[model samples]
Target: MTLLPGVRSATVDTDRLRMHLLAAGPEDGEPLVLLHGNLSTGRFYEHLMPTLGERYRVLAPDMRGFGDTEPKALDATRGLGDWADDTAALLHALGIERAPHLVGWSTGGAAVAAYAKDHPVASLTFLDPVSPYGYGGVRADGTPVTPDVAGSGGGSANPEVVARLAAKDASDESPFSIRNVMRALYWSPTYRLPPEREDVLVAEVLKTLVGDDGYPGDHAPSPHWPGVAPGTRGILNALSPKYCRWADVVDLDPKPPVLWTHGSADLVVADASPLDFGVLGASGAVPGWPGEEAFPAQPMVAQIREVLDAYAAAGGRVTVEMFEGSGHGPHVDAAHRWTEVLLAFLVSA
Candidate 1:
């Protein structure tokens, strides 16, 4: 199962724009697109894909506003809709008439859901993602609403509820916390980047960050800092773009195998990814609005259960699995268990 064997780069130009992607696996195999979480690019799946082998053709694109594809098109407003359009264009450019299996993490998950709904994907996976509400932010029982901002443990009063929702996770507070250097190593869980590497990471993001189109480069930062930092709000503020709800597109179509994953204890996206969008309203990430508290973790934890439900409701083909005790990108961040879960679900599909 050596799926994505190495770093392979290609730029696919749609009639609308050019998309840069790092890919691996058999070109002729069943197609699968790995959408990275907000902070990094598709390189995040660099390890996970190598194990999938020829089982599927895996393409991890630097979405319109991310990675090498930065300085996105005016059309590429960092809006999830623009992300979906590029995804569709990428498929069409590659002659993938049938939608491949779509696996989205964090913001990418939101993109996957918005696109796969109408795109005819074989299956869908929300890999430990934040759906706008608390996809990555909640506990199984629902407690800490924010993972980044320092909290008095008081309810949110920040213009945006999510912004003030800040609280640190155990890992973020650990002496070994990976937060400071995470941007440099998309796939490195045990590894941390040195200063030189950190410099490179910053340069990379900055270089691809803004385009001649006047649209700023895409750099999705984490919602919270791991350690208690005073500038958590400032950091988030700098990273955030004007809010555009990806959930608004969910109603466009709804036919596909939908799988959602989230860590009950994840402090990253944390229930931020909206499952329903509450009729298409903004979450706390927007400026000038109070940050919203996350949904109870019980329902968030039920994503896998919902996948099973999708299976039961849709006959034999099931579309969901739970990555227990995992954080962020389950298959990549918590590969040991979630990888197995991913394989099982793929085979099931």
Candidate 2:
């Protein structure tokens, strides 16, 4: 809601749906699109736009089912293809014919990778991205442990957190409150966003759609150990390995330069993430884990490395930067350093 100076807001109409976006810099400058992750709006990149916009036309849009974008039904069956197609439509609508440099955070990282799988891009920067194989239900080798992909997707979301989000509980009265979750998981527990900025982010998260057509989407009963599988629709379902996978990006023709930046202390997308069923099962948090051999914690970061390494092996330029002690959000926790590295890479890319 709070726009830093020089940032402008706009509503652009694309064929698929109307999109709300934040943009800065000259219209004629090279285009640079920043995609935010799940549970966040384009506003999450507000602070970064000014710097990025100085040299490029920076645009950040609220993805479908999040922020002010029209709450269209997301087809999880298409995986991130819906989002990738949406970005293409938005770019075409904006009259941007040239492939633009892209930066994606968390879920947005997968979104950008999906975009690159079928489109040309000037460059790609992944910030603590989800695994190339998807979020959960996969082994270290990116293979699904169960046929139904149990313990992943919409049903895997904590009901208490979803309920709190639906209630718009901004107060930090409960551990699951939006504000508290943001503080605890959005960044390293040791770092804190300024009060005003934190308020803005919490407000943005509250605007997210919360049901089958949105955040956690819907779930179906599964015969597998965890007993739940991703339904055919919603954001989380789109992230399930059943439908989501971007490792194919490694095979793109005229492959673009890639920069993978991550925080060492990331908890949201870690091998031992508290949200992962395998981790929960290992910790005795989820009963009947079925033992490690049957289902081990997903090696999220390692999967990314393998995919990116394959990308490099296939002739794409790749760079990896790890920010020690930061949490899931390096852009928020290590803004200056992240910006510096990104700008340098963009110039070379």
Candidate 3:
């Protein structure tokens, strides 16, 4: 992948895993850690590294199952614990004595939140993070809809999409193709990255390790309506409400300042996200949906707001910014504004 002018890529061996990282700026600059979301790697943030590196030491790593990192098996039962611990190990190995500013996008949001719960951080920037209650099978109040947390986790992953990813299909031939999926879901529908940049991003996604130990992970047969449940391995299982939940950030002692930013048109983490089972069922995309009362669309945005509100009520400083007309990746679709707001927050924090 082509890194920005100032960015440099390297490998670091920690006790936990050998990690691939993109780093820039002076080694002694204020540390800034950027964590990427699912289906992506540290390369996803390359476009922003140079600008961010101007004043801080920017380190973005490929987490366990993605990019050039060693494909260590992810224990889904730990939720984001493995990633949090991995980050801690990475920082310790680098001798980062000072707490670093953390910026997480999508799934990375949960990872950083998990870290902040037990570790100190200068600040947190959540860019279109997952719901505090986890991804799916959740109600408005952050409770699971089914006893087994069915209709979520590994099974929720689209098989066609998973297969395409496994095949490393980079073409836009089908809607399920990885390239098409990125174009459709990663940013505003009208926004397009330059051809070369898009090529790099798509290649980065194709590097994801796919299987029970990776992307969607494994699944189990469920007695519930969806007929499937999360298995104890893989990325999606880690994201299941059964294992993933970060709402307890409200109770963190000496909480770090938080900046939450999202796109107004984000479909990936919406109250009725198109990928959500409830939304699919409600729209008759999935048969035998059990109706709205039993499986209403998960209120993802509302759940995040509720948790942040509670965090604020409990005396944590919090800021929220919404970018109109953008999609899931505001940093890509609204780079200038996102950068300005992020820098302003980091400066004041």
Candidate 4:
């Protein structure tokens, strides 16, 4: 992958796992950690590292199973705690005594929240994060659709898509191909990544390990219509509602300021996300749907708003910024605006 000038890559062995990372700026500069989401690596942040590196020590690590990190199986039962603790361990190994400002994208947001619960951070910036409650099988009020958290986790992942990823299909012709999936799902249809950048992004995505200990992980059959529950291993199960929950951030003794930036056009984490099976089933995009009553579309954005509102009511500082005409990765789709708002928030925090 083509890294920007001054950007360097390395691998550090932490107590929990060996992590591959991209870093820039002075080591003595104020620490700023950038965390990527599922199926992505530290290379996803290559563009932003240099700009932010001018003032802060920018560090982006490939979380556990992605990129060059050790291929360790994740404990889905711990929710995001495994990732959170791994991040903390990395910081300690790096000798970062002071809390670093944190920036998380998508699943990375869940990791940062998990970290904030037990560790201190300078501030939090969530870029289209997952719902504070979890990914799917939950209502706006954070209630699960089923007792076993069915209709989510590894079973929710499309088998064909997972197969394509595992095969490392770089073809853009098929929708299930890794490159096409990134172009179609990662950004707004109106916005296109340049060929070179797209290549880099696709390469980073292909680096993701796909299996029970990796991408989709494992699942169990359920009596429910969607009929699948989280397994005890892998990234998808780690994000399942049965395990992942970070709403308790409202109860932190010293809550840090939070800056939440999301795209109005984000289909991955929207109120009726097209990527959500419940929504697709309700819309007849997927056959054999059991109807809306049996499995209503998950209100992911509303869940986040509710949790943040609770955090605000509890006397914590919270700010929400919605970027119109942008998709899930606003940091890339609307880079200028996102950087402006983020820089201002970082300064204020």
Which residue pairs show collisions in model 3?
A: none
| lDDT over C-alpha atoms for residue 274 of model 2 | 86
Task: Write model 4 residue lDDT over 174-273, tens digit each, in one string.
Answer: 8889888787778888999999888888888888889998899999999876778889899999988889888888898798999999998888889998
10 residues in a row with least lDDT, candidate 2: 110-119
Model 3: CA > 4 A from native: none
Question: How high a TM-score does candidate 4 get?
Answer: 0.98
Consecutive 10-residue window with the lowest summed lDDT within model 4: 285-294
Give candidate 1 misplaced runs (Cα > 4 Å). 1-6, 73-79, 132-254, 271-320
How much lDDT does each candidate structure score? 0.50, 0.91, 0.92, 0.88
Give the candidate order by descending lDDT: 3, 2, 4, 1
TM-scores for candidates 1 onward, in order: 0.60, 0.99, 0.99, 0.98
lDDT comparison, 1 vs 2, better candidate: 2
- Model 1, span 1-349: residue lDDT tens: 1223464778888865777887777888888898876545666666666776447788888775457774454332343566777789888999887558888877676677667545777777777654332222233432333544222111111222222112221123432223442422233344344655444443433323322232222223334422121121211211122322333323433445456666544544433323212111244333332234432222443443443454455453444555555545455456667767766777767
